[model samples]
Target: MEEYAREPCPWRIVDDCGGAFTMGAIGGGVFQSVKGFRNAPVVSLKDSLLGFRHRLKGSANAVRLRAPQIGGSFAVWGGLFSTIDCGLVRIRGKEDPWNSITSGAMTGAVLAARSGPLAMVGSAMMGGILLALIEGFGILLTRYTTALEPRLALATYSSPDPLAPGHLQVHAR
Candidate 1:
């Protein structure tokens, strides 16, 4: 019985080490969360850009879905481009979405400290309003700038080849 108990002690040590490694990974995850909150501006900018791209893609899809069947291949490509352009316009107004959170927090803190109770409440309200406005502005700007404009163009097949008989080759631009 004593030998068996001692034999498992080494295995227990290995298990403890594994537990410690997992704990370390969890701690790292927490650290990253904190860091992400702190770096909200950078993250917000990235998000705005991504949103713009998403909206642009949605616009392009809308065009492809709505286009009439009368046009030839050039017309199809032109229609796709026109739809993408509209999406770009929509996205351009939404850049810098995070700008308000970072800037508004600082501005709000300063105003809150400087003002009286009534003033503080008023300032806080104003801060909320300002933050919302800025966020809206950033989103619109990003959509127009990144999504609408052809920053990088690719010429992949927009539709399935009539010659090919399979569903896998049916591409949408």
Candidate 2:
């Protein structure tokens, strides 16, 4: 879990390698041939669920990465307050955690200013929206995080060597 403050861009925390990983596709033929196991009902169910979970988790992670990078770059290009407002509106609509947090901070800053009654009301509405977004983001993040771990564990543990000729061998360290 190393953090580096580089240029603003979406980053993925992939396994420390620069190669490709294959995933099963439609039709049981590819999976059955690679794993050398006839597709049973239970196995098919498990594989399908695992694949769905992986796709969901990966998409969530990508969103988390891109949102911050885009927000940061926008903040740099636009004024910080404008970026904060844009972030808030996006989060309120999309329910992203980072955007919600930024929105909250911005609302607080705006409210602290001695402004008119309408401005205060607008700030309060923004704050309420930010809260809702935060809650939604929390629920989504938890669901996706939980789903990812088991799917990844299954994939890691169930590695079948396609080159080998016989039954599946669980590799031992």
Q: lDDT of each prediction vs. the true structure?
A: 0.46, 0.46
lDDT of 2 by residue, 1-173 (tens): 22323222112112101111111112222333333322222323558887655555554554444444444443332343334645464457643455545555565546545887677667756765766677687778778987776655553323366665644444333
Encode model 1's per-residue lDDT on 1-173: one tens digit a residue.
01112223344434444544455445544554444434333323558786555555554444343322212332433333233333343456442334344334444544466666666666656765777787788668767767645633433444477566552343336
What value of lDDT does candidate 2 attain over all alpha carbons? Answer: 0.46
Residue 148, model 1: lDDT of 46
On TM-score, the leading prediction is 2
TM-score per model over all chains: 0.27, 0.30
